[model samples]
Target: MYIGIPKEIKNHEYRVGLTPASAHELVAHGHKVFVETHAGEGIGFSDDDYRAAGVEVLATADEVFEKAEMIVKVKEPQAIERARLKPHHTLFTYLHLAPDAEQTHDLIKSGATCIAYETVTDTKGGLPLLAPMSAVAGRMSIQAGAHSLEKAKGGRAVLMGGVPGVEPAKVVVIGGGVVGENAAEMAVGMGAEVVILDRNLDVLRRLAKRFDNRLKTVYSTSKALADHVASADLVVGAVLLPGAAAPKLITRELISTMKKGAVIVDVAIDQGGCAETSKATTHAEPTYIVDGIVHYCVANMPGAVARTSTMALNNATLPYALALADKGTKKALEEDKHLLNGLNVCKGRITCEDVSVALDLPYVPAEDMIKEL
Candidate 1:
């Protein structure tokens, strides 16, 4: 099989799909790997490094996309990238298609096999491929939120971790999954009064035990979320529902109740956000003020720290990539039920139930499509 790695073309996106080490592994398995020029540069891997690993370096994305059977990418295909997709091509990436109708339509029309990393599940119902990047985005949410709270940024001018004599800032994190847990960890480490809310009592209990009262866990309700927003200096929106759009936990009315100059980092922006005012922003211009509240809704938060993000993402995706490349998507997914759940769109049919329901498209069983393939 011929594998292609393209440089991410999304705004402010610097992470590449495959690293030299990944290419090396594929080469060892007798698969031909072609990497777009400068794809690994952002993560400090040179073309020479890929060449040294027995991977061919192509001069343009066109060459890589045109020649490879399977294309591995870091993000969903942007408009320009989508135009390059051809029928029967395999796209393996983090395709968050639930909210992006345009991309979903394009992929379906192209008649390509689209396996979304974000939809892949583990035995425990956790999103396997999204976990690494979620961990990165969750931790960075606090760092970005804290920066947005600085006086220079037109924030409330209060420090998250106050001086010895002053009280610390209050942080409210909505969700108790990977993103929420990491956000809470960062906020607590910064000495802020952190409160995490979720509907899951089991998650809340586990968090309570892990933090040992350093961070507070609350049962999430509309009233509880509204009340917490009023007093929070920093609010992190981290809710998720697999391949569905994130629920709006913080409405425009709720923002009005929050203190003036409060900072909100909506880490769930990739899944259409948990905040009513959230819009995908870029790193170059990451924040905007709405209803006297500052919103940092960079859709690709992990992209800002590409080195750390790329390495972490590769760690999670490499094994799956190997499996798919070795056995083909059909064989691998057929054998691994967990991976079959990752199949979103293949051969002009929608396979994931959540994505189909979110987009109001027909849901076809993955087995039906895999058998044909």
Candidate 2:
């Protein structure tokens, strides 16, 4: 199998799909690996680094896309990248297609086998490939929210951990999942008063035990969301519905009621967003004022720390990648039910039910579509 790693082209997305070490493992497995020149340069891995790891360095993305059988990328394919995709290509990356109709249609029209990392499942029914990046985004949400609360950033000018004589700023996390938990962890460590809300009792209990009562874990309700958000200095929208668009829990009316200059970091922006005003922003201009509130909704938060993110993501993706490479996409997916769950599109058909429903497209079961592959 020949695998290609193209430099990520998303705005401020510096993380590469596979690291030098990860590519080396593929080479050791007798698979040929090709990467676009400077793909890993953002993470301080030079072309020589990839060469040292036995990877062929292509001078252009066109050549890499032309030669590779499987395209391993960090972010979704841009318009040009998507145009370059051929029917023979297998794209393995994070494709948040639920919200992007253009991407979904382009993928279908390209007639390639698309496997989304975020939808891939583990034996325990958890999103393994998405977890590492989610953890990174989760932790970063607090850091971003804290910074957004400064006066220069048009925040309320309150410190996260206020002086002993002053009361600490309040932080409200909208979900108690990985993102919410990590955000709460960081906020609590910074000595801010934190409240985490979720609809799941078991998740709340787990978080309660993990935090040891340092942060308040509350049952999430419409009243709770409204009351807590209105009073919070920093609100982290960490809700997720898994392969579906995030529910708009924070309404425009709700934002207008919040304290002036309060900050909101919508971690669920990748899946559209949990807030009505949350639009995808880039690190170049990461925040905007919406109804006098600050919104930090950078779609790729982990990209800020490319080196750490690349390594962490590779650790989680390498195994499944090897499986697909070793057994071939159809065979590998057929063998592993969890991996099969990752197949979003194959042979010009939508294989993921969530995406089919989200995009209102015709559904073809993965099993049926892979047969012709």
Candidate 3:
């Protein structure tokens, strides 16, 4: 297998798909790796570094895309990159296609085999490939929300951890998954009045035990969301629905009724956000005011810490990449049901049920899709 890594072209996105160490391992297994020039430069890996790891460095993304059988990327292909995709290429990346009709159409039209990292499951039914970035985004949500709380940023003038006599800011996390757990942990550590809500009793119970009564765990309900969200100084929208669009749990009316100048960090913005007012923002201009509420909805939060994010992502994705390379795409996915779950689009057809249903497109079982090919 000839694998290609392209430099991310998304605004302010700097993370590379594979790290030098991971590429070296692939080379050791007799696979040729091609990388765009300076693909890892943002994360401190030089062309000489890639050369030492036995990777051929191409000068342009066009050349890299042309030279490899599989295209490994950090973000979804932009319009130009998507145009470069050939029918024979395999695209392995985070494709939040459920919400983006343009991207979904482009991927379907390209006739390439697309595997989304965010949909890949483990035996434990957790998104193994998405978890690392989720963890990063979760922890950063607190940090970003805290910054957005400053008065200059159009937020209520408040400190996350208050002074000796002042009360701390209240934080409400609307999910108890990886993102919510990490956000709660950070908020609790920062001495905020933290409350986490989720529909799953088991998840709520787990969070309650993990926090050890330091934070409140509420059974998520319409009333609970209305009450907690209205009083919260900072709200972290961390809900997810795998490959489907995130539910709009925070309504526009809810935003209007919330405290003036409150902040909302919608971590689910990658899947179109959990807030009605949330639009995808970049790290460049991470916040905007809607109904007097500051919204931080950077779609690629992990890319803000490119070096650490790249290494962490590679640690989780390298094993699967190796399996795909060693056995070929069809054979590898046919062998692992969990990996097959990652298949969103293959050979111009939708293979992910959530994505298909979300987009109102035809659905084909992943097994059947691969078998037919």
All candidates: TM-score: 0.99, 0.99, 0.99
Better-scoring candidate (TM-score), 1 or 2: 2
- Which portions of model 3 show Cα errors greater than 4 Å? none
Candidate 3 structure lDDT: 0.94
Give the number of colliding residue pairs in candidate 1: 0
The Cα RMSD of model 2 versus the native structure comes to 0.7
The Cα error of candidate 3 at residue 273, in Å, is 0.4
Candidate scoring better on lDDT of 1 and 3: 3
Q: Write the per-residue lDDT of candidate 3 for residues 1-373, one digit (tens) a residue.
A: 9999999999999999998899999999999999999888887999999999999999999999998999999898999999999888989999999999899989989999999999999999999999999999999999999999999999899999998999999999999999999999999999999999999999988888888999999999999999999999999999999999999999999998899999999999999999999999998999999988999999999999999999999999999999999999999999999999999999889999999999999998889889755
Off by over 4 Å in 2: none
Which pairs clash (backbone N, Cα, C closer than 3 Å) in model 3? none
Worst 10 residues of 2 by lDDT: 238-247
Which digits, one per residue and each the tens of the lDDT, describe model 2 over residues 37-128?
A: 99999889999999999999999999999999999998999999999999999999999989999999999999999999999998887899
Candidate 1 error regions (>4 Å): none
